[model samples]
Target chain A: MSAGVRLEGLRKSYGAVEVIRGVDLDIEPQEFVVFVGPSGCGKSTLLRMIAGLEEITGGDLYIGERRMNDTDASRRGIAMVFQSYALYPHMTVRENMGFALKYAGVKKPEIKAQVDEAARILGLDQLMDRRPKDLSGGQRQRVAIGRAIVRHPEVFLFDEPLSNLDAELRVQMRIEIARLHSELKSTIVYVTHDQVEAMTLADKIVVLRDGRIEQVGTPLDLYDDPDNLFVAGFIGSPKMNFLPAELSGGALTLVEHGGQTVPLPPLGRAPQEGERVTLGIRPEHFRKEGSAALEVDVEIVENLGGETYVYARQAGSDVLTIATGGARGLRQGDRMTARFDPSDALLFNREGLRIR
Target chain B: MSDVAAHRLDPEAAEPSARAALRGPDGPGRDMIGPAVKYIVLSLAAFVSVFPFFWMLVGTTNSSYDIVRGKAWFGDQLLVNLGNLIEQVDLPRVLFNSFYIAIISTVATLLVSSLAGYAFEIFRHKWRERIFAALLLMLSIPFAALMVPLFVMMASAGLINTYSAIILPTIANIFIIFYFRQATKAFPHELRDAAKIDGLKEWQIFLRVYMPVMRSTYAAATIIVFTLTWNNYLWPLIVLQTNDMKTMVLTISSLNSAYTPDFGVIMVATVITTLPTLIIFFLLQRLFVQGMLGSVK
Candidate 1:
C-alpha cells in the first residue's frame, strides 16, 4: 500500500518572497527520506507541500505515478505527526486515536480494534483513558504517534516530531520512530534541522539550503563524499574545515599556513596551475602519524570522556580542530604538529562545489 | 581551635547572621495582617455589588407601597404580586418567547462565529487578513447607528414581527466573530495540519475535531450570547409589534409604564427575566474562566 513520491520543480511562495524555490526530488516506496537544513531554509514548507497542507505556487507533484497537485490533503493517502504532538487536549488517548478513523468510514468495532492495536504498538494502552494534558511529554508524543499509526496511511509525514522532547527523550523517540518505519514499512518523509537525527534516521538524506536541494544521498555517502562545501560542512558535527590553497602542477599549495603543499589526485577538470581552491578536512580525519603535518598551537582542549577535540591555531587563522583518541596530555599554549593523509582532504572551488 | 571552640559555645553567634537579618524588627504576625486587610476589603466590595440583587428578590415579596417606601425585608405579598403579574401580562408565553429567541440566537451565533473565527485563524491569506482587520474595525461601529438600517432591511424582507428578523441580523455579529478569532489564537495550527492529513475534509475537521476540542470556548460564548439576546430591549421592542410576540424584557418594561404601576409584580418579572442568564453563568462559570485563561495565554 506504500507509494513513491516525486516532485517536478515544486515551488511555494508567499506573495513576492519565494520560500520554496523550485525543488525536485524522487522518494522511493518505503524509503525514509529526511529533509534537513537550517531554519527558514524551506524544509518544513517542502514537507507541507508534499502533505498537501500548503498550496503549491508552481510545478507538479506525483504520488505513485498519479499527479496529485490539485488533490485535497485528505485524499493524498498520508498522515503527519506534528512537532507539538497536537493531540486534542480534551479527548482521551483512545478517542484521539479513533477520531480520524470515524471520518474514514471505518466501522465502530474496526475503529476500536485499530485504536487498540495502535495503543499496544506504542505502549499507550494504559494511558488510553488519559487526556493529553494529564500525560507527560514523552507519553503525549507516543499518543501522537499512535494517532498517526491507526490511520494506516500509505505515506507518513513528520515535521520535526522530536524537536519538542528533551535531549534524552529525543534519542529514545528517534529509535522508536526508526523501528516504527521498519515495522510498518511505510514510505515516510521527515523534516528536521538536527543533523544527528537525519544521519541516524534517514535512508536517504536530502540536504537543502536557501530553498534549494544541495545534495541527496545515503547518510554515509553524504558524510564521506559530499558534492559541495556546504554539504560537507552541514552534514558533520563540529563542521568541516576549509583552508585556502592555490593549485600548482596537480598539487594544492596552502597560502595561509606556512605555505604547506598537498598533492591532489589527477582529474579531468582539475584547476589550472595557480588557480585558488579550498581544502576541506573533517576534524576526525586528522592523524597522529602521517606523511603530511602542520605545526600549530593548541588553544583549547575539550575532553569529552571517550574522545578529545583539540581546538588549535596555525599562522593567523583560528580554524583547526583535531580529534584524538582518549584524553591526551594536551593543554593550552602547547605547540604541536597536527598531521593527516593527503588523500583524505577534499578540494573545492571558489563557488563551494567540490572538485572530485 | 580555641576560637572555634569559643564560637561553638555561643549558639547565637554560631548561627548565620543572614537568619537574624531576615527576621527584621517585625515578626511573622505583622505580615499576616496585610493579607487579612486585603481580603476584608475585597469581601466588602463583593457584598456591595451583590446587595442589589438581594434587594430585588426582597422587593418581589413586598407590596408596591412598601417597596417604594424603601422596605428591604420580605413581606407577605409574593402571592399578591404573582396574581397581579398573571393578570397584567401573559407571563408563560412571554417567557417562552424570550427563551426561544435567546437559545436559537445563542446556538446559531456560536456556530457561525466560531466557524468564521476558525477560518480566519487557520486559513491565512493576505486578502483574508485584510478582510479580518476590516471586520475588527466594523466592530467599533455602535449597534445604535445600524439599528435603523437593520430595521429597514428586516421590513423590506417582510420579517418585521418574525423571530428570523431578530436572529438573522444578529447572527453575523462582528463582536462575537472577533471574540472567537481572539480565542482561536490559542488553537494550535499543528492540529489542523494533522487533521488535514488524516483524510478528513475541512468541514468534517471543524465539526469533529475543532468543535469538540474547543468546548470551553463554546461554553463561554454561550453564556455571553444568551445574556445578550435575553436582555435585548431596544431592538426587540422596535421589531416585535404584537403582545403575543413580546419578549420578557419588553413585557416587563411595558408593565412598568402604568399610571399606578405595581412595583412588586415588576420586580418579579425582572427576576424571571434575569434568572435564566444567571443560571447559565453559574452552570458554566468554571469553563468561562478556563476558556478566558486559554485565550489570554
Candidate 2:
C-alpha cells in the first residue's frame, strides 16, 4: 500500500546554523519525487528528516494521515537505501535481507518466503549465499535494494543509491529502480546531486538551494518554465548560457560583447529602461533558422558522434556552449554566427530572480 | 675487442653490455651489503629474544645445582621437577583459579570496553571528546598509584579475597577502550543507521551487527587481556590470602622467594604458567594481525 507525505514548515538546525530552513512540500502517494541540488544544499538532510533519521527542529510531518515527526524511522513505515549500500558485511544476502523480519518476530517460513520473493524480484537468487564482500558493487546494491524491498514499507527513500557505481552500471541501476518503482507503485523520495538522474527518474523534482526550496515542479515544467535563475541553471545538463545585458529602449544590449542587440521577449510587466538584466539561453536553443545571431570565434569543439558542442565566444566575452547538430566540420579558431529565437531566451533581474 | 674498439664498432650493443655489467650481482652497484647487514642485525635480535626462552626450557630438564652452575644442556630431571612442583603447590587449584579469572576478565573487559568505545564514537554530545581526552590522560597515571586506592575500595566493599575483586577492576580497561574506539572508527556508521531502520534497538545492534563485524578486534583484545590477566601477579598476590586462592603466577613467584628455592621446580612452574598465554596467542595470531592493521576491510 502507498501513502502520501506532507511536510509543513519543516526546519532543522545544528546549534545555531540552520540547515533546512522552513521547507514545505507534499509528496503524493506513489509519486516518484527527486530532490536535486548541489553539495551542502540540504537536499539529503531534508530527505533524512522526512525519513525520520533527523529530528525536526520546528515543523509538522505527516505520513498518510498520521503525524510522524516524533515517530521512529522503522515505525514510520519507510525504507531507505543509503549511498554506501550499508549492507551488513558479515551476513549473507539471505540473512541480510531477512534480518529485519527475523527481529520483527516473523516466523521462519514467512521470513524465508518474503526474502525469497525479494531475491527473485532483484535477480539475487544465485547470490543469496554470498556475503557483501564477495559480491560486485552492482550486486551489493541489488542486495541492498532487496533488503529494503523485503520490508514492503509504504514509502521508499533513496539517498544517491547509484552514485557509487560506474557510469554504465549507474544507468543500468537507474532503469532498474524506475522499473521497480513502477511495479511496486510506492511513494519514493530520492535525493541526488546529478540533475540527469533527477530529470530522468522523477515524476516531480524539488530543487533545493542553501536549505530552502528553489522550486518544485514536474521535470519538463522546471525545464520549460523555471521560477528562478538557480532552478533554470541547475535542472539542465549543459548549463544554460547567461549573458550580461541592459534593457534600454525596449531592446536588450549585450554589455560585454560590443553592444550586440536582440529584441526582448514579451513579459507580463514592462521592465524599466536602462534596467540591467541577464539573458539565459540553452545550448540546444541555438538553431540555424533563428532570427537572432551572435558572431563569435570557436575556441573548442567536443564531438560525441551524434551531436557536437562548440565552445565559442566573442573577443573579451565569456564562452558559450552551442550545440551544433551533426556539424563535424567546426574546429577551433573557426569564426561562426550562432543564432537563436529571441522568444526562447529568458531574462533574470540583477538579484538572480526570473523577470517573468 | 678492446673496450674502445667495441664501443666504436656498435654503440647500442656496447651500451647494453656495460649497463648489464653494472647491474649484475658482482658489480659495484649490487645491493647485497645493505640486506646482509639487515639480516645480520635481525638474526642477532631474534637470538637475543629467543635465548631466554630456550634457557627456560633447558632449565626445566636440569637439576637445581646444574641450573645454578649455568648448565645449558638438557638433563633427565623433568619428571622429578614436575613431581616436586605438583607437591609444593596444588597445581589443579592454582591452574583453575588463573584460568577462571583470566577468561572472566577477558570477556567482561571486552564487553565493557567495546561498549564504551562504541558509545564514545557513535553518540554525539558536548562532553564526548573532553571525556575521552580525560580518560586517555588517566592512562598516563601509573597503575601503581591506583593500586592502594583500589585495594582500599575492595576492602571496604568486603570484596578482598574474592574473584570479583580481580575481575571487576579490569572490566573497564582504558587502553582496550582506546584500541576499540580507534578500531570502531573504521566501522561503517551506515550499518548502524541501517540497523536502526531495520528496527533494532541499540544493544541489539551492538550484539548482532557490531560484535560480528568487529570480531577481529575482539580476538586481538582477547589475546592481550587474557595474557595480561593470566600473568597478573602483584594484585592477586596481595589480595588472595589463602593457599587455595593463589594463581599460577603467584605460586610461581612464591616458589622463587622461598628460603631454599628449587630452580628446577620453579622453571617447571614457569613453563606451565607460560603455556596458556602461548596457546591463546597462537590461536588468535592471524586475527590479531588483521585487527592491528584494521578491523574492517
Please name the candidate that would achieve the greatest TM-score relative to the true structure: 2
Two-chain DockQ for model 1: 0.63
lDDT against the true structure, each candidate: 0.88, 0.93
Specify the poorest-scoring 10-residue window by lDDT in model 1 chain B. B18-27
For each candidate, give the TM-score of chain B: 0.87, 0.91
DockQ of 2: 0.76
Off by over 4 Å in 1: A248-253, A258-270, B1-44, B295-297
Encode model 1's per-residue lDDT on B72-183: one tens digit a residue.
9989899899899999899899998999999999999999999998888877676998898899898788889999999999999999999998788778878878878888
Clashing pairs in 2: none
Give candidate 2's TM-score. 0.96
lDDT per residue for candidate 1 within A58-175, as digits (tens), equals 9999988889899988888788899999887778899889988887789999999999999999999899898898998899889988988888888888999998999999999999
Q: Which one is best on DockQ?
A: 2
Docking class of 2: medium
